[model samples]
Every structure is written in structure tokens, then in C-alpha cells.
Target: MFPDTPVTSAALSVATRFCSPALLNHCVRSYLWGVMYGGAHGIAFDDELFCVAALLHDIGLTDAFDSHRLPFEDAGGRLAWVFAVAAGWPQERAARAHEIIVLHMRDDVPAADDPEAHLLQVATSWEVVGRHAEEFPARARADVLTRYPRLGFGAEFLGCFEDQARRKPDSAAAASVRRNVAGKIAANPLETHQG
Candidate 1:
């Protein structure tokens, strides 16, 4: 039940242009998981905003924006801000979208105050780290993975993170890379699936 608004379509198109198929699928799955998670938890959120945030959350990992000194999350949030403004979204909504992108990486996101941001954080974590699997329904998880196959996402995404760490040594990516690159790579949720 992803939003199909023009802005959502444009966001997806932009993401598809920049991201690999695996990353693109991850983005879509993040949105799906966010929506499902929110609905299951009775959290009211703006679906379009969540969709845009999810789709563009990893944009900085792409080649075009990867060169920036900012952490991938900040770079992606900036890019999302610009995209939202250009798409005629009001300043407040644009900022909210930006916040959602930027804060998705934090471990302690305040979900009660901003459900969209919370959902994005949880969804991204779930997609990347396989956390919170028990919170969501099994059927929804299967449906999402079926719709958006991992396609070796673990290797591809870890490679991207490693490259980011190499290029932006002072960034959060580098810190994460240094902390436990092998463990994180091995722990990727997509690595378990052969299909």
C-alpha cells in the first residue's frame, strides 16, 4: 500500500536512476516495512512522506552523492530536502522529510513524537540488520521480500559502505566500517537468502 502520488513516483524514479537494483529494492522494502509497521502499531503517519524518506534515505551511498564529505545520512537528507522543495512540498513537510532521513540512522529515535521518522528508523534497521522481525507479521515480511528480492544486497551494500568509509574517513560510515566491517557485512539480512 505504498503511496502512488506524483512526488512519490518522481522520488522512486530518482532513486532507481542512482541506486543499484538491490539498493533500490531495499529502499522500496523499507517503505513497505514502515507502512506495515506503523499500521500494526497504530501509529499514524504520512504515507507519502514516509515513502519519499525511505526511497531517498540511501541516496548518498550512490556515486553522485557519495563523494560528499557529509555522512551518507546527512547527504541523503540534504538531497531529500532539495527534492521536496523542488517538488513544491511546503517547507515544514520538506523539513520533516529531511529529519526522517537524517534520524533514521540513530538507534534511539523518538517514535512517539514523530511516527514517520520512527517508522523509517525501524524499517531501515529491520531491512539492513534483521532486527525487529518478530514485531511484524510473517505474511507481510514474506510479501515484502517476494516483491523485492534481495539480489545479493548484503554484498553490494557492504561494498558501498566500505567504499564510503574509504573515501570519507572522517564520516560515520568510516567509523562504522572501522568498528566491525566484517561482522556487519556478515550480519546483513539479505545474506541468508539464496533466492
Candidate 2:
């Protein structure tokens, strides 16, 4: 496992124990975007905790997704809650995190007061859109722009991906994701959501 560096070492270790490099890279990319959002917006947040939470937010998916469990569903939430509590996360945060992860697929869920939830949404959106862009065509790009407008971090997150794509065009994964992201940017140049 990577060094703790102000975050929970044990959590990081457990969260990443079975993930693939592509998944890990996806997590890093999302976390970096969260860091960028924090830096530019000057939000008062726990950087270390946010970073760790953003990185591990999907860790429970190893079991949850595999078992076809829906975290948003009652049974899924209970299963996820139990797993998170057993995994050593504080009860309060675990309950909240379980809800967010379970309902992450629901676009209508209201944003949580917890800043970590916002950061997690920003990070997860970028990771998913970026990772899947290669398989999707330009027509699908509009969905990302439309779906994440309320996220308030979409444009900045896209800019970051754009910069990375421009700097490293040879990156198969980055290039694939950036293709659609670039289209999203071109389609909506004036869009910048508020955090």
C-alpha cells in the first residue's frame, strides 16, 4: 500500500487491496480533480479526509457490485452499512457514505451538506466519463455536460482532463476519455457551475 500521508493507511490499504491499476489510476485522477477543486474554490474542508474518502468511496463496490447489490436500495444500504462499519469507518461517516454510494446513480438525489459528498461526486463523475469516453461516441458527450451541470465542478474537471490529454496524447486511457471530454468543452464553452 502507498504511504498514509495524513490519510488513513489501513483504509487505503483495504480499499485498494483488490482493485486493478486502471481502477487505481481512475481513483488518483478523481482525487487530483478534488484537490484542484479545493485549491481553486478555497472551500474549507479536510483535505486528507476528503482525499482518502474520495479514493475509497467505491471500495465497497468490490463486494456490493459483485453481489448485484444496490446501495441505494434498503437491503443494499444495510449490507453496505454493515460492511463499512466492520471496515473501521466511523458510524456517522459510514452511514452517510453508504447513502451517497448507494444513491450515486440517482441524478435527482439532493447534495449532502458534507463537503466530502460533493468532492466524491466530482471525482467519481470525472473518473467514469474519462474511463468510458473511449467506448462512447461524440453524441454521448452531451449527456455528461447536461447530467453534471449541477455538479459545479464539471467544467474545471474537464479542463484538467483537457490539459492532461494535450500533454499526453499517447496515453490510451487518457486519450480515449479526453476525446469525449473535449467535445463536451467545445459544445459548451461558457458553462461553469458554481461550487
Candidate 3:
């Protein structure tokens, strides 16, 4: 279950309504991974903000929110900003949520700079390409996968990125495609491992 808060609940509602089943599962798993990673690293975070940001980081990938020219992260970050403000969050707190979503797409974020962003970036990469995946216990990994199966997320996610690349040639998605993200997605342990 997600952190209990109006913003967190709203995030879940919006994500479930906009994201595909596969994408939604990925979003949820991202949060679980971050939680486990934080616990393992003894990194404390604001649970409600972290949970809301994690669930909405990929919102721009959805048909309802995708921007034609902006990178998905920027678009998603903007939407999350609006959502946070609407949920009665202070501007500074809402900005942190926006920052977390945008920063998750980065290659790395220093924990000292922003723990939530650092944790999310690491967690998303862990889910997408198995980066630092071994740090997580098998039991917890299996539990999360059981709760939210990949549901063909690898194939679906590749398609999404491919489309994003085609539509926005100068995007992070394009960079990912150039790096052969498809290969990484295929080789991710979660894709082949049977929990």
C-alpha cells in the first residue's frame, strides 16, 4: 500500500486512470524498490512526498498527459507540480515532488543534494536495468513482483520509448534508444526471473 495522504491517494487515482496496466505496475514497483533501498541504506525520506512522486514520475508517458515537444520528465514534473499544489501541499513541498519526478530520469543524483531524488533515480534504474539490483533481498523482490507483476513491462516499455524517440528525436528517450535500451531491458533480471 502507498503512504496514506490525500496527495498520495490522488497520485494513485490519477496514475491508475492514466497509465496502462504494465506502466502502472512499473510505477508501483519503483516505489517499493526505493523503500527497500532506503531502508537498506538507512536513508530517511518523506514518505508521502516520495510515494506521490514515485507513482507520478511516468505520468507524461500516458496518452492523457504526454507532451508533443517536451521531454516526458518535464511534462510529468509539471503535472505533478499541479497535482501537489491542488492536494494542498505548500509550494516548496510541491516543488520537491516536481523535482523528484524530473530528477529520476537522470543518470545519477547525489543523495546529499536530495535523498528522494537520489533514491528514485536509483530505484527506477534498478527496476529498468537491474542496476544495484543485488542489494535488494530476494524475498522482498519476489514480494513486490508478486504484488505487481511485470505484465510484459519490458516489451511494453521498449515500445513506449521507441515511440517517444520517434516523436522527439532530441529527447532522453532518444538517448536511451541510441544506447540500445532494448538490450538492457531484455537482460534485466526481473524480465527473465520467475519470482
lDDT of each: 0.83, 0.48, 0.89
In the range 92-190, model 1's lDDT, one tens digit per residue, is 899988898888876557768888889998887777666786776666666677889888887788788888888788876677678785575577544
Identify the candidate with maximal TM-score.
3
**Poorest stretch of ten by lDDT in candidate 2:** 64-73
Off by more than 4 A, model 3: none
| Candidate 2 global lDDT | 0.48
* Cα lDDT for residue 122, candidate 2: 57
**What is the total number of backbone clashes in candidate 1?**
0
The alpha-carbon deviation from the true structure for residue 17 of candidate 2, after best TM-score superposition, in angstroms, is: 1.3
Q: Score residue 195 of candidate 1 by CA lDDT.
A: 20
Q: For model 1, what is the alpha-carbon lDDT of residue 106?
A: 67
**What number of clashing residue pairs does each candidate have, in the order they appear?**
0, 0, 0
**Candidates arranged by lDDT, highest first:** 3, 1, 2
- Model 3: per-residue Cα lDDT at residue 55: 95
True-vs-predicted CA distance for residue 119, candidate 2, Å = 1.3
Compose the digit string of candidate 2's lDDT tens values, residues 42-148.
65665555655555554533432332222212333454456557767688766765565544434433234656556656556544444223332344334434433
**Using alpha carbons, what is the TM-score of model 2?**
0.50
Q: Candidates ranked by TM-score, best first?
A: 3, 1, 2
Which candidate leads in lDDT? 3
lDDT value, residue 145 of candidate 1? 79
